[model samples]
Target: MAEKSGKAFDFRLFKRLISYTQPYRFTFYFVAFAAIMLSIFGVLRPYLLQQVIDKTIIPKDGGLLVYFISLMVGVLFLEVISQFLFIYFANWLGQQVILDLRIKLFRHMLGFKKQYYDKSAVGRLVTRAVSDIETIASIFSQGLFMIISDLLKMLVILGYMFYQSWQLTLLVLVILPLIVYATRVFQKKMKAAFEEVRTQVSNLNSFVQERITGMKIVQLFTREETEYTNFKEINEKHKKGWIKTVWYNSIFFPIAEMSSSVTIGLIVWFGGLKAAQGDVITLGVVVAFIELSQMLFRPLRQIADKFNTLQMGMVAANRVFAVLDTEAIIENKGAINLEKVRGDIDFDDVRFSYLEGEEVLKGISLSVKAGETVAIVGATGAGKSTIINLLSRFYEIDSGTISIDKTDIKTVSLPSLRSHIAVVLQDVFLFADTILNNITLNNPEITEEQVQAAAKEIGIHDFIMSLPEGYHYNVKERGVMLSSGQRQLISFLRAYVTNPGILVLDEATSSIDSHSEQLIQDATDKITKGRTSIVIAHRLATIKNADKIIVMDQGTIVEQGNHNELLKISDGYYRNLYEVQFAEV
Candidate 1:
């Protein structure tokens, strides 16, 4: 999908982001006040030098000179104290805002439906949550403070310089338009460059994440050389991006320096002529003008540099807001709480497609009575898993109604509806936590005895107990620390622990060995004794005892009956699948 685009920075997004900082407005205001005072104090230092030259030293008044020098020291001390407090509070406020924003972003992302993850990249999400947030924090903590201080200091110095001598100030002001024009040109170029840099960085991050996640496959295929070349290309692109950024910065600084130099030279020549003529211009005033000239250009140069940084920050902000603004189409709108469901499932003419106009489930209707065990068997891509997904409301049907206990799933609150269903898919995912935790994942309140009972019922308790840490053994990512069969058993235990009214086993035994499959089947029979169960599998033997067998083909039901009835109809899809499995055996 093409990403949402607009101006480089969205004002509404910024407004929302700033709202988070409302709690720290007091601190920000105090910091700004301190910064203004410090700038005032800083401008006064050069004026004090001018005073010592004009009113004390030039007049041979050593006592007055000492007093002014002591006063300068006192002003310097005050500036230092103010700066310390400003930095302390600004840093504190920035960190707090970042912390709150990170947490809020995380919660929002978590609340998004699975389809959102299906469309978004993990690296891009991580970049927004971590890198982009840090960039914004820097802008808030350092950039905002510096901009205020520099602009205020420049304004004060310019006002005083013009007040003292309008002619010299006007000479400097003549180049103001040129400076602004140049800054705009540079800003535009830098913004474009930074946008490209941000894109390249995101690509590099995605590449690293992909390679790391598939490292085992890469090594197994002995494609290290090819992967290395790919990485080198991405790295080279990143290097070129940074080089372009540096090149722009390098050129901008020289232009600013040249502008400042020319302004100072003009003042020296013009101001000196006026002083020589005794044209109401003292040596003290001329010296102060020179100091003020430096002060003015210093901030102008700083502003140019900061503008570059701000442009980079704007690029990051654009990416961050893109994520924040994504609207979840499927969300609970009203309080339609489902309680004590009896697990009667109905799919009334359900039709769905991941992409528009390409239906994957077409006009399919099925009703599973309360506590009934239904097995759906189909060829690959025959909509068996899609039916399971629809029943769980993972994806909304394009056309039709799905309900549990007569209430349309859409009308029910998602959390409450999903809380009563337990699903175990072919590919089990286990966190890097203890074995006990993985088994009791759905029920953190489950006791140790309950965990042990569930494991024993699944016939995996002996194997678990053999480990050094027993139930406490850590399951690595995807349960790599355990065998495939052991992982499948743990998944079964997890589902059983939930005590769900509706159980879904989507190829649950497909990953296990025949012996483990038998154990899981035995446990499944026990678990489904009182709960409604929907088993989607390719193995016909596994569902021989199902109360009903549904055979589907190309998103539609082709045949459905009891095991004996399907066998009697030799042309039925279920009988053919049974023959194929028997032939393999």
Candidate 2:
């Protein structure tokens, strides 16, 4: 149910939230001072009005009336100034804190291992970084200081009211307990409603993000009506969650308003009776008490609302902190810093699993000497690409070791290690940027001339220049402006410009047409010269000339040798695989 109970206040969460404001302590202190000043000014005007009624207007002392009126206006002016400072600085402090927090969250996410992201939704993380942090900012701007100021003002008003007429003040206290009970109930209900609202918001964001990213598939499969129905269901849930909050507000505010109205009536009745009965209560006392009652009740009413804001902000903080608290970051405990690598690779009895008890790569061992071109081929689910994944340390092996140049990769700093390796995947990803930026990825060290030279060598320079803007052409998101082959060609240029020691092509030629396959094949042959390369290809013919071929089945190596030697094994795994392709062609 959307009405599930939750804590209206969490002390530890609040303390952690306050720590983010440590850098802006001066602004924090200034805001505190402004709150105090606003509270003092709030009560002073009502008290001054009492004086104006009693000492000047009542006795018709015109000279004294002018003086009191001037005093009241001056107090009002200071009150406005103090109110401005409090509001301005509080919001300023909130924005600054959220800015720092958003940056910190994003930086932490960048360090997380791929495993962390495997089961996480990009949209939920986006909500945590963007909207959730924005809610947290309200804690400073409208929740804490505003609540404090209201409380202080109410206390001062109560003190002054008791001093003037203990009898009338005692009568006003009669309505207090009922209002307090109502406020407590309202606050609890609202907290739960707000929590439900936040949850639905995250779900809505996730659904929209996933749908948009997969819009191509949705259109291709003609699932528009089905997906639209799904979106409406989600949107309806979000609307219902928000309506729960509205329902609670509708019930609570009117109750608060009625209590305030009833209290004012009580004061008027009791104070008027006392004055008529020859008591100390006078007209000025009655009038001032009326104003004081409002000062007292309005804030009490607002306190409930502001407390809800505080609770909602705290809920958001808890969500944001949950992501910040994730310990899924890759362990980079290596002390060795390899500036350059020899590209000699070894995997000794390496074992791994994405899920427990479901091993994907089992007791696999392989070696590639420096400057050697090795190809791995297998049917789907045969752990072909898993080898490249493990080699790149994108996923840690459950057992055994992976080494590069005779040094354990675990003993090398991640940046220093990855710098010497380049990977080109079957599905190439290009940012929404110009071709030059996509190729160089904005690396200042690689010049335009260098990219042009590498493209010419790979035989894609003319193709790139034939585009509308040539190298400066925008590829749009995910390279939608280019064909599958063109994006792959750009990926090759991207990898080659790095001057990497090792190259990994994971089915890079799988989906392209024959023409593009030829171009990529030629590019691959050229770049593989004098460099250690690992090629995983669906087309056995493409890797026929590779120095060595490792054929895998069910996560284990079934056959491995040079292409000619593998062909000689009748009915062998590689032989059958090669024969099927040859017959298909």
Q: Per-residue error at 479 for model 1, in Å?
A: 2.7
lDDT score, candidate 2? 0.90
Candidate 1 per-residue C-alpha lDDT over 1-585 given as tens digits, one digit per residue, 9 for 90 to 100:
124344544466556667877988998799889879978987998889889988997899999999999999999999899889878887787789888978877878877766788888788788889888787776666766777888999899988887888998898887667677777677777777888888888888888998988899999999899999999999999999989989988887788788878888888888889988988777788888888888887887787677666666666766776776777546776368877879899889989997799888989998899999999998999999998887777777889998889988888887888889999989989999999888877465898898898888778789889987999999878788988888888888888987898999999988899988988999998999978999988888888889988889999998888789999996778888898899999
Clashing pairs in 1: none
lDDT score of model 1? 0.83
Q: Residue-wise lDDT of candidate 2 within 1-585, one digit each (tens)?
A: 012235667777888889999999999999999988988999888888888888989899999999999999999999999999999999999999999999999999998888889999999999999999999999999999999999988888888889998988888888888888988888888888888889999999999999999999999999999999999999999999989988988998898789889988998898889878978898778888888888888898899888988888988888989988888877889999887777899999999998999999889999999999999999999999888887777888899999999999998888888878899999999999999999899999999999999999988999999999899999999999999989999998999999999999999999888888898889898999999999999889899899999999999999989999999998899999888999998
> How far does residue 573 in candidate 1 sit from its true spot (Å)?
1.2
- Which residue pairs in candidate 2 collide? none
Model 2 clashes, total count: 0
